[model samples]
Every structure is written in C-alpha cells, then in structure tokens.
Target: MNRRVSELGERGLIRRLREKFPSLHSIGDDCAVLPGIRCPVVTTDSFFEGTHFHRWWAPPQILGRRLLEAALSDIAAMGATAKWFFTALSVDPGIGVNWIEGFYQGLTEREDVILAGGETVRGERLGITLTVIGEGEDRDTILRRSSLHPGDNLWITGLLGRALDAPAKLEKAGGLSGKDLKPRSGFLSSAELEQLRAFLQPRAELELGIKLRKAGIRCAIDISDGLFSEASHLSLESSVDTVLEIDETLFFDSVKDNPLAASAAGEDYVLLFGAPVGLEFSSVGCSKIGRAETGNGEMTIFLDGERVSINAKGYDHLGVRK
Candidate 1:
C-alpha cells in the first residue's frame, strides 16, 4: 500500500479522481466559487484510519458524524453557517457497502449541510476527506490566533475533559469483549446520556459564535486542542501575553488538573473566543478565565494566582495510534 509511485501515475490518479466528480462551478482551481454569498469561506480537511479515528472503537456512522463535526467546527470558528460539502472517499477491500451507507446516514443529519457531490475509489486503506463551504456576514467573520487585542477577555464554551477522560463504561464483565464499549442505557446509571452525547457528537457553535460576533467580539477560535495550547496560540499570534484562570468548579467529577493533558487532547471542538472586558452574554454559559496582556510574550495560566506546569501538548496526527 505504501509503494513508491511514478510522478505521472500520481497525476493520472488525481485526474481520474477529478473526472469522477464533476465541478458544478468554476471560480479558481484552488477555491470554490460561491455566487450567492457575498462573503464566502472555503475549508478543506482530511481524516484517516488509525490516526483521526480508531476503527475498532467507533462505528462507521459515529465515525462519519465525527468527520462532519470536525469540519463544521472550522466553519463555526469563523462564525459561518455551513451550506454544503463535497466529499472524497477511498477505501480498502475490508470496507463494505453497508458501512459506507451508514456513514452517509450520519452525515445527512446535520442541519443546513448537504453533500453536493463526491468521489470514491478502491485503495489499500480506508480514508475520507471533505471540503466544506460556508458563508458568514462581513461583520461576523471571525479569525483564529489573529485579531486578538490587548485587554480582551478570553472565554471558552462548555466544560472540558469530561468526554475524553471518563471511561467508556462496559456492559459486561469480560475485558476482551468488544460489546463492552457499545452504547448502553444502564452502564453508567449515574451519568446522563445527554452529557456523553456532546463528546460523541459535538455540534458546531455557529449560532452562538455568530451572535457573539454580532454582539461585538472580534477574535476567536474553536477549542479543538483544548484550552491550554489554543490559549498560547492566541497569545503568540496577537503579540500579547495572557493569564488563563481556569474555573475548576466547571469540571466533571472525573476532571483532573493536568495542564498538558487538557491542552493536548483534541476533539472537544468548543468555541474559545475573546471579547472586550465588561460584556454580558447571558445567552451562553461562558467563564472568563484569561486576559490578554502586552508586557510578557508568553501564556501564563494561573490556578488561584499561582503558576504551574503541565505535560499536555496539542494533538499530533502522527502521534495518534490504534
């Protein structure tokens, strides 16, 4: 599967893939043209087996839903509403027709998103990539790492660490059984299914972010790499320093205070945004944990006013293993 290929063969492969999927419109070779939207944004991403996901851990439908959510998070970060998506899928002989159909079923459930078209091919391993096109108003377009300013209050939506830290409760006692991790109503009697639902399928914060932008926010990013790494990115890009005061009370029962763990673990996909101090947003549950400063050129997170060290770094795609 990893054999070296001639340059001509690679070009031929790309040409054939393009031939299978017809282009509906031509804006540029790199960017998709959106005639209806005055302000349009195009984003492209890919997910691969044993990296973006573990096939043994997630069902095909759930895997598909995760793929869609990851893309939508990017749109939401820009305060844009998703319009449509184009998908390209390649699979090894191990995949079946039923699995592909189930994948599409989950993808179709998202609001305001339709699969305009896609391509398919037979390969040595399973993989899928999607390019999502979305639209936002001129005022509502947000940016990541950039656009931050001095004295802006940093806020993150939703609680962190619950979904990933909590163990997948088993239905049976046998350790070897694959059925142990399957969704069960009674496995964790004390835990609410709705809470786990967010981790499993993170809905984009499009409306909330757009509303925040309309309410006068200028800088923002989605918390895919958790709070620690993203906060540093914001500080570095905006040419400012930040003091992150994490709200310890918002954590789930299983929450722990390993800073590196919090920062490096991806897939939370919540919005982390900056607003001017003294703004009131009663609609969304946000906690003001940090402030941008200009004196120091580093991120210093304070827990009850003291600096601490942690081991978590952001997710590296190659680092994730089956």
Candidate 2:
C-alpha cells in the first residue's frame, strides 16, 4: 500500500509525524520544540558533491562527521544547545551501500543529539542537506547578528587559517588548484599534522556558545567563511565599521606573514563575538583581536599598526571602499 499527501491532509500529516517521531515536542505548533528547550533555534545548510565538498577528500565517515560539524557551527553561533538534527541525502547507488551506512554511523557520533526523521532519494550526484535545531533559555538569551555595537571589542576562538590549509593541499593533490610544489614527506611536524586534522575533523564550539549565552553575549558569529568576509558581514549586519587590528599571534604560523591570505581564508568554524570594551575573557581561550567602530558597514584590517588593502568577499555588496 502507498500513501499520498492529499489523503492525510496537513493536520493528519503532522499527527503522523508526531506519532512516528516521538522525540520532537509540541509538533503542529507554529514552531516545533525539543524536550526541555525553552526557545527553538533552527539552522539549515546544503552541501553538494563538487561545489561544496568532494567525496574523495576524506573517508565517508570523516566526511559525514565534518558535514555535521559545519552545520552545527551555525547553532553554536546562535548561543544555543543542539538537541536534534535531520539529514536529507541524495545518493547514487553507485556510491555503495557501505558508504551510506558509514556516513549515517558518523552522523550518530554525538549521543546527546537525536537524529530526527528525514528523506533520502537517488540523484545524479551526491547532495546532503541538514537541518539542526537547538535551544536557548529564552528569546532574550539567543544571540543576534545585529547586536554588535560601536565601541564593543571583537573576540575570536582558536587559530585562523588552519581550516583552509588541509583543503588547499587536498585540492592541489587532486590537481584542482595549482600543482604541488614539493613532494609528500613521511615526517610531519606536530603543527603541520594539526592543520590537516583541523580540516578533516573540525569541532564546533558548542559549550562555548552556551557559556557565551550565559555570559550575556548578545552578538556572535562562527568563522565559516573567511575572517575578512565574516567581519564585513558583521559590519553590514550591525551597521558599524568593523576594525581588525591583527598581529601574527592572531594567526597560525603558516599564514602569519600573509595578512590578506589569513584574513580571507575561511572555514575556521571558530566563534567571533563582540563584548563591551575593556571586558576580558582570558579564561575561555578567546583572543581580543578587534573592535566594532562607528561607521556605516565598512571593514578595516590593520596588521602591526599598518593598514592593508585588498578586495574582499561581500565587500562590494556592502558598498565600501578597499
């Protein structure tokens, strides 16, 4: 027997969903809720085979874990606790049954979160879409992109440029980018190994987000794009001039000299938040890197007291000078 949407209708469909997926609370409301969550925080992301990621980049399980990590970063940015996630996959059977099983196994690595029901279908190429839901204490506890204000200090978690390192090397090895300059070596330094691990498996700042929410941080963003792009976004969002006064200490040892590369390389997945000037967060491993200034949606970068110039991502959309 087969079922049709017209037969069940909307209410009936919701009732079925509630019955089948008992983990979700308060289904059929304007917004569904998770158990014990006060406010719902929802975020969605789409990943395709070639454009966003390449299957050959990592093992199926590692790739699946990384995808979940990337999407969870959004929930972390909202200062919320992720409780559930629904994943939709478009896979070709040629991709193999073991690969699919391994992928799902990887997604279930976190016991705290439940994998809600989702749909899967055959497609020409692989595509994965994830919808993650988290919770905050209340409406006021959720962070906002527009809450950063002038005179607030900008803080970032973890080293920058490491996330882009592994992918760039992988692309070069796959001959997508430029040719690899040097041959692969068996001996790898601890730092070099760390960079590769950072990309293959990145961890979202989940506990940090909860702490930031408890600490009353009103505005924050995860560094998914590049530092430059994220800073421009925050500026446009808050309608303030974002100024990054950076030093080599703010970056990984590899790209410290290249300010433009360090600033533009994305996918760090670290938290960047604005706190009141003079406020310190030394205990939480956060570095005070910049400040939000009074202006209209412009971003400025200063390296060692000298201002550098470059065309940046979302720079034109913000309608600002170089």
Candidate 3:
C-alpha cells in the first residue's frame, strides 16, 4: 500500500463507483473542449479585490497580464490555441481611466488573441472576469485529466515551486501603494524583484502543451492550485492511484528546504502531465515526478521509498481551505 491520502475520503468513495463503471472516465479538465469543426474550447475565469488579488499587489498593466495568462493556462492544459476573449470589469469610483487603459493595453498585447467585446460597470470593489475561447490544435490528442491511466509516468514542465514563496516575499514588503512599484523598504533586492515578477508575469505554455500532445501525452493539469492539490484532482478524475516523488531539485531554490510545503504554495502555472514510460523529456525541460498506479483515486508522496503524508492546501475563494 502507498501512503495515506490527506483529506480526501470523498474521492476514495467516488473512485469505487468510477471503477465499477469503467465508462464514467470521460469527464474533462480545465477548458471545455466541445466537439466541432476544430473542437472549440472555452473557459471562464474571474478575479476580484481582496479575494483573488489586491490592487496594491502589482501595477494595472502587470495585473492584467497576470490574470489573462492565468485564464489562458486552462487553454494550454487542453493543448488548445486561444483565438478570442471577452472581458467584464466591475470597478469602484476611486479607480482612474488611465489605469483601465493600461490594463487594456496589457490584455491586448498579444496579436493572436482578439478582444471580441467587454462590459464595464461601477461597483464597490474592483473585479474582472474573462471568457476565453480557443480551438484545439489537434482534436484527437487534446489533453484531459481524465485521460490518465494506471502505470503512466508523471512529468512536470519547469520547476514545481518556481514562485512558491513569492507571496510571503512580496507581502513582506507590504506591497506597493496601489499606484506604483515603490517598496516600503526603500529598495528591494534584485532576487526579490525577480521573484515578484515571476508571480506577476507568468505565461501560459501553449507551445509546451502542443508539444506534449503531439508527443502522445494526453493527460495534464495546470498548477493554479498547489501541485499536490492538482495532482490529487488528476488522480481522482482519472480514477487511479498516484505516487509522487519529491526531489529536492524539483523545487525552486527559495523553497527547496521544505519542498512538501512549497509544492502547495500554488501560482506556478506550469504543466503537470502523464506520459508513457521510457520517454525522456529532460532536453525539453521536463522531469518525471511520479507515476499513476491501479487503486482507488488516491495520491501519495514517497521520499526514498518511504511514504509521507502532505497537507497540500489549495487556494479557496471563500474562508474554507481545501
């Protein structure tokens, strides 16, 4: 037996039902890739003040890029190419038009993504929602979390905790003045600045997703939540057992000391996928982190072959922590 799964007994129960009914595995992941002349995919993502983000955390331009890429990450997970987007903004009276223009500028930076339309309304708090539409590059090989199978090798693009500690690092400085990137500490170290930018300016790895799909990988999930959280979801959705190996080198230098905790920090926005065994992708910047196995939908971490339990905290919109 593998290690005990943390806080997911409900998934275990559901797994039995899925196992009994083998045909129930075709659910979906991330963006909804509906059948059509190019397999149209669509996703909706929303962010609001004091919950998803803070105005002081970054400049409007940076925030716009960050949130857009976050939404586009869903498209990448399904190996789809973004074609268009619609934005809806809810803002307070205190916000200025210049800030809105800057946000729009960052949002429309890419020529590939056209702004179909948007709606703006005045509200007490600032909020932005985006509906991104895309088409699958190849309909047959579109990635989905439910496509993982037992004995599949788990591979991850880039480091697992690239920006894991960035939240505390940025919040330590008390953030900016809701205007500019001026630090209260008078100055920030170059390393800190780089880490802050890592969190704020992440890009959806569209090319990587397409490459993986072409390479015969058909299962993947974006790391918007913690690594373990998403990994658990992949296992549950696929109705298989997963064993994750935590290599110290898999984490960023800042969080390597406590890789278990770091893997739960989220905001990496990288791809974690399942591939066939004997396939090496290190040249393309991917590392095998684990494997799926035959069992109830459960996940475990084995360090040096000994199972360890991890309380991987996923981001929640409300006060609940899952």
lDDT of each: 0.65, 0.74, 0.75
TM-score (all chains, Cα) for each model: 0.76, 0.80, 0.80
User: How large an RMSD does model 3 have?
Assistant: 15.0
Runs off by more than 4 Å, candidate 1 = 1-35, 139-141, 162-196, 257-260, 310-322
| Candidate 2 TM-score over all chains jointly | 0.80
Q: Which ten residues in a row have the lowest lDDT in candidate 3?
A: 1-10
Candidate 1 residue-pair clash tally: 2
Per-residue alpha-carbon lDDT of model 2 for 253-318, expressed as tens digits? 656666567667788899899999767887789999899999999988776776766563422222
List the candidates ranked by lDDT, beginning with the highest. Answer: 3, 2, 1
CA lDDT, candidate 2, residue 36 = 66
**Cα lDDT for residue 24, candidate 1:** 21
Q: What value does the lDDT take at residue 176 in candidate 3?
A: 46
